[model samples]
Target chain A: MSSTDMLQVISKNGKAKRGAEPNLPKKTLLAMYEAMMQTRLLDERMINLQRQGRIGFYVPSTGEEAAQVGSCMALDDTDWLFPSYRVPGLFLMRGVDIQHLVANCFGNEADLCKGRQMPVHYAFAEHKLVSISSPIGTHIIHATGLAMAQKLKKDKGISAVYFGDGGTSSNDFHSGLNFAGVAKAPVLFICTNNQWAISVPIEKQTASETIAIKGEAYGMPGVRVDGNDVLAVYDACKKAADRARKGDGPTLIELMTYRRGPHSSSDDPTRYRGNQADEWLDRDPILRFRKYLEVADMWSEKQETELIERLKAGINAEVKKGEAAGQPSLETMFTDVYANVPPHLREQYENLVRDEGTGHEPDPDAAFPL
Target chain B: MSSITMVQAVNDALREEMRGDDDVVVLGEDVGINGGVFRCTADLIDEFGEERVIDTPLSESGIIGAAVGMALYGLKPVPEIQFSDFIWPAFDQITSEMAKMRYRSGGQFTCPMVVRTPYGGGIRGGHYHSQSPEAYFTHTPGLVVVIPSDPYDAKGLLKAAIRCEDPVIFLEPKRIYRAPKMDVPDDDDYVVEIGKAAVRREGTDFTITAYGAMVAVALEACEKAAEQGWSGEVVDLRTLLPLDEDAIIQSVTKTGRLVTLQEATKFCGFSSEISAIVAEKAIDVLEAPVKRVSGFDVPFPYTLEHVYMPHADRVLKAIEGVMTY
Candidate 1:
């Protein structure tokens, strides 16, 4: 009954608990498994690529796939998403091409962001997913605001924002949740409690029993779920989405999970973490979900092995295409400041063009020495 | 054309833009039934209804955060911050989120919103209500900062800002909201382009560059200079960011002297940037060093307000310093 108690459906042994059968179509469940498998493969491959110096950076979403993919599946195509750095599963679920994502990592010309942002800081307007910003919890307010706009227009669409346990401690998270509560904006605040923010543990982040309880202070229903259970995550997110579409206010769902890898390729978990990764590996969401499907007579070991081979070949082709696109042209710096370049920017651009291949024009009256 | 106060001009611009574009919505604290604390959004709710004229909670961050969302969702949100002093709560949303939305998103997203707030020190609202925060917004790259000196410019620039594709910080000079009413064009489509300065007066002796309420102070200082046999030209820098550098350079070239005035703290203020620009480009033609008249680096105090603010006397002194150097 307490909020800290995890809301779970499928048990670790792949058995459905009392009144917890999600009744999802066999095809739908299999699709969820495939998406999770793809995410797992991409996470592993990207890490290898980053370590191999083929890509600049990567943020692996190994343990949190169920939370990311399940919640993403709950929203309609018209709904907007404000994702953080670790939600590549959400992007993949949105039907974004794997090549486009790899291109972003390469900072290639094919990258829509044009090498402006980091590898996993992806965005797609066509899919209505707002770009992921590096600043933690900053997108919560944006998600709230976007939902408010939808509410004003009497649109049934809602916004689902994803953050981590580290994000719940930020002022932006408070401001965003409080506003959504006051405005009665249709929004779902999804906190992927992976138990660590780079180096800081969740115990150090908050004294509260769970991040979901923090939603009560902001006048929203808070739910905690076994994030490793795909059925539980999907059920909770679907209920929250239904409430938002029905004019109910925001809901905060804390997906309880763990980080099964280093925070990013740049980090060294060995320095800070001990046996946690090994411990979480046993409760791997993908493996547990695969057990659920296999118990239901829907999935087999051969199917998974085949799916992985297909995903690897697909990922390899995409990585090769992304690498071949190369970096964006050097002339992209002066554009996009405004819809129309003003005269001053035009002059500066012209100056750069005139001084091509030479060093920048030196200012004789430089405020400080260069 | 009709004679109107700065507040009326702002109100007219909002009404006109909302009438023209259904996507344009007005929102802020007390912006609905209360019609804004300063009446800048008076009766907008009555005309546009509650959906468009949103009365948000007393949360500056919420107002801006929601406005950014609305803009990102293909709506033109003109959010009022009530007072410039109270905008700090939403500063993160404005600078990091709203300003960077375009560039960071690689042009796939744009926040075409106008943040309107009454600023400057004159009505003795104490420190909490009297601060010029344009320099902070101007420091940002993707944002356009607009400060209009009079009713005509206020109406024109607000309309222009609403039409601009990028985010704009429209600073309304609260001190002159009702003073010196001028005839503003009634045309609904009239707009003063952003990033352009209006030369209010032309002279041969020296250049006085100012904007918002200080432009009036500069005009008074120019009057005093005329009595002293010194001619002065006044350039109203309607837009602060993407500054009208050409206008500054031309005025300084003709007069060979520059005097910049602003109500914000002089340290790293807009006046400092303008002074630096003139000094850098027109240094050889200058008859004297560029002089800056600005508020001292101190919190706006309740009493001794005049001493804290840049007044006509200070502008005149700067003119004298620049002319006689």
Candidate 2:
């Protein structure tokens, strides 16, 4: 497809175009709609928790649910995902435990990261989901590297990495694409062009006509898809993944979407841009997908109310469990810095315990031999 | 055992590791067919083929970032950064991502990779090609910093680093890459333990602490001090972080006087950390104040490299000054 031409399956009014619907199983389509809805609800609850001072901070992907969920659903179980901080749907769709994810946000004792990282920087190795960092576009090369390793091992798995429009300007974006192109690494570069990166618009992030077109210079096919249409995104991503698995090299996909919320709890988008009009609001991915499901006789107002009620109660219980988990043990600060704790860290830990009047005795064997 | 140069020893370590472990792969600019700029990875591509021995694009961040991903995916990647001076481009990947991978992921993910780079000055490489950038990596936690003074230690330490569970910044003293041949073992199982210091000489007057290329300079200075009727000890710190404080303290307590030498600048260099450790742990047994002989606080000059780098005479002066004080 041309860079300027967008591949859209579902229309803005929630009607599928003629012969454009993806051939996914009914169960898969229902699952995709549920995941998108769950993501939207979770984001709203997390933001409310942040505002209530129950959590420190959160990044809400309000309007970009289809981009995150659809692209993640296209991958096989063995494939790897390197996600941006905004894409919490990727974690949920990958089958991460909701309680674990909530605990990570609370940085509680049950948190897998041991409260070491900031909230939303979730890491689940079982799902083949790489950890998230705050740096933009850095993980792009990492996805390429993982894909290269898979290719070398003759493995059937490919890697997919996500970034925003602003990430297009990062040095690693160029490096990752150029290197992956040269190596013929089986990976997909997915950019969720959500119109605004913080306060900067996409026009200011790049001078190119579109982010997808930039892939042409790196020797990769560029495709643009409707981010509000889950079926379209799934079709594009699955096709790209199949090409990568077949050793045909990488593909660049631009998911045309919009961020309908603030950058974070701390950001004030009102200071920079005017209110988003109703035209943009009507294109919400969850709304469009819900319409599509209803048109297919798959969903109704009764089912929608029940799903929302069940999700709300379930999310609330997980949040309560996370809150009641308590803070991570003080000693967790020193652990995981290395495979074995060196003498220096041991001494420091001892000093901290003594200073805190915890009366904790030093374990002679705890320190690794120097 | 066979006598070999430091570069040859490095090559032997990579070859053995790759042959032993199918997961160990080597990648960098000119590392495949060209066998690296210093020939440290020579003939690796011939044995491992193009899949394992990769010649990547000339992007430092790309090389290191890709290595991080490879390591995360269960491959032991040894990425060479042509020179330590050019390593700044990948500094974010090393410090932010690779070093923090295990901690940030709560031990679910780990980056077990070694970043091999040639460092330090003596070959008139000027500012760009020669620099002692160990202080940067040493200051960052969750990273193992290792340097070797000779071929035997280079091969052994590199092999150990490859097997390490944490990320390692293996700085090779490029100036001594072709130094006098030393007997490096050919056995595949031979490996040196990390976080250990080797006492090269025994002395009663003072102790000289050094690592990498400075170990040879310290040894030369020790001989000069002995010729002047003064005894000095030489300690080679194989690992910079998680320092072998016991070895340092033991040597300092015996000799009473201390002299720290490094090729990096004196201000906030690795030598400062050494001096501080001695002051904190073994201050009561000191005969005189610890002295540091290091490069001046100036950029490495091409024509004046001999003046920029610390020599035996400078180290000898520090030893005499500390002993007399």
Candidate 3:
């Protein structure tokens, strides 16, 4: 197959070069760029939030803007998105309000998760985004199952699932891929092989040269790309999403990206990683795209200044809006425990009401034991 | 109004439910072509076709574990374990993973799967085939445990289980699979509510609560007690977990004494929970302490089969002891 068939555009610089690109207008591209910049600023600010002990840990999709925003931008609004911990870029590009992210990170009252879940375990059922669990590979299986259901429902849109190199080690990963392949389910598994899983290197995660190669065993096409390059990620994801809609089954795309920050806002990356960090920084997708736009005279230093000011102001407003929502009601605890809470739990909640106002925190250490 | 054996009732229930819902699928070891070791799933493959009736390999974890995954996707999976004693291999997948997924996802997810297995001792099947394992699941929170004693309840409760939106462990007393039969509701739209007990006999002297095969023994003991001039109210606890505490309290209220029986090890059995609840809820109504008449705390006996199962005589003795106290 010709290489151009797999990609719509290729450039080290983010310019309006007219070399076989999509019909996407210049205005749409600029909007996408603004979204990516917003996500980066948000990531940096959230890390500061963590440092100030305002929010808990966060996993930034920082150096991989092209991969995150590009693939997400390619899909329709109705298409299902199953994201791993990172990918705030995709979340922002998909139009999840910045205030919601702030409420989520701060785990406040306005948070859709009811403050019960950890930060980053985002769930917006209306957006077709299934809730994320702390367990790594469980959602891979769930995504496959959801895709199969969509097949039964004859849904026009395809399911897009995100995972990491470390997630591929789970047994469900193999089972999920195998089932989707055999059933010819419309789904795309985008593996953001960011090279590190909390200190475990990609070399240790798999002996295969690329994360996409594992797809061969499941009888699906596996493709490797420059994850930092937004154009490549967009083009590859677009092709796969089209094939999926055509009932061609699933494809695994390995986007070789990097984690510029700590695994979360926690940890010190300088302790273990090598000069590879400096190398990844050089290939930084956002900067490379900015350079390409500069070469085309499509972007300027003034645009960067305006973009930062707009994003910072927008984010600060959202942060204030999120904080003003106040903490989720202590009463939010009783809700979402079940579709219909049993009498036992209701009695416990009533006891709490009778005692003070809301139920005291149940003994989590005794119940969860983990 | 026809009489059927326990296994036949299960077969009838599966056939009826399949005819009712296209999404219900039956998959397990030897459950399709081979008709299951106990013949509980006989003729399902021909009736429902391969897509609905699956004969899986001997992988307990894979069978129950994958059913959990399948059920989460909207298909109703009824997975059968060959024997109650062998369910532990899939217990972690069932109890920890499947049972808790809905709650852990904080109600965002639900797995509606049922694991049907033949349980309890009576025939000379020894420890592996015998053994009552419902106690382990009764302790689990999200799972609904159902053990049917006769054909009537089996057909009704199982249909309820297959449709219910929770992981249910449906234990069919293997020894009584062909032992007895009774009239059941017709037209196949029967659904006995889960977590409710059926009263076999109503009497005011003492209460006898049991389930699975032991309910028959308890009834027989109550019959034998009529000669000795003692009254007994027998409650067949159809659902063990989310147990019918209401029926138990009501029965104990009149009898003023309770004797719980099971074909399981006496230690940490379902009877233990019944005793605790009776003490907690019905302390005022009790004229005597609630006693549990269970099998010895040993691996089910292989050589001494009759001694292994709870007998009518033991039930009678326990009833007499509780009433006199």
lDDT of 1 at A348: 84
Q: Which portions of model 3 miss their true places by more than 4 Å?
A: A1-23, A265-278, A359-370, B14-142, B165-175, B221-230, B263-269, B293-325
True contacts kept of 3: 0.11
The residue-by-residue lDDT of candidate 1 on B1-325, one tens digit each, is: 9999999999999999999998999988899998899898999888999889988877888789888988988899999999999999888888888988887778899998999999999989889999999999988878899999999999999999999998999999999999889999999979998889999999999999899999889999999999999999999999988899999999999999989889889899999998888777889989898888889899988898978998887788888898888
User: What do the candidate models score in CA lDDT, each in turn?
Assistant: 0.88, 0.91, 0.78
Task: Put the candidates in TM-score order, highest first.
Answer: 2, 1, 3
Per residue, candidate 3 scores C-alpha lDDT tens digits across B1-325 of 6778878889988999989987788888899898999898899999887657776556566567557655765788898999988887677667766776665554666778889998888878888888888888887778888998888889989999998878899999887888667787666888788878999999989999999888889999999998899999999999987778889989998889999999899888889989998898889999988888999988888899787678999888888898677
TM, every model? 0.95, 0.98, 0.84
Error of 2 at A163 (Å): 0.9
Local accuracy of candidate 2 as per-residue lDDT tens digits, A1-370 = 6977898999877899999887988888878877888888899998898887778788999999999889998999999999887888898888987888899988888999988877889989999999999998999999999999999999989999999998889989998999999999999999999988899998898889988898899999999998878888998999999999999999999999988888888888878887863457878888888888888888899999999999889899999898877677777889989999999999999988878866444333321211
Q: What is candidate 2's TM-score against the reference?
A: 0.98
Instruction: List DockQ, one per candidate, in order.
Output: 0.71, 0.88, 0.29
* Candidate 1 residue-wise lDDT, A83-114, digit = tens: 89878888888899888889888877788987
What's the distance in Å from true for residue A38, model 1? 1.1
How would you class the docking of model 2? high
Candidate with the greatest TM-score versus the true structure = 2
Q: Please give, as one word, the docking class of candidate 1.
A: medium
Residue A308 alpha-carbon offset, candidate 1, angstroms: 1.1
Q: Which 10 consecutive residues of model 1 chain B have the lowest summed lDDT?
A: B54-63
How far does residue B248 in candidate 2 sit from its true spot (Å)? 0.2
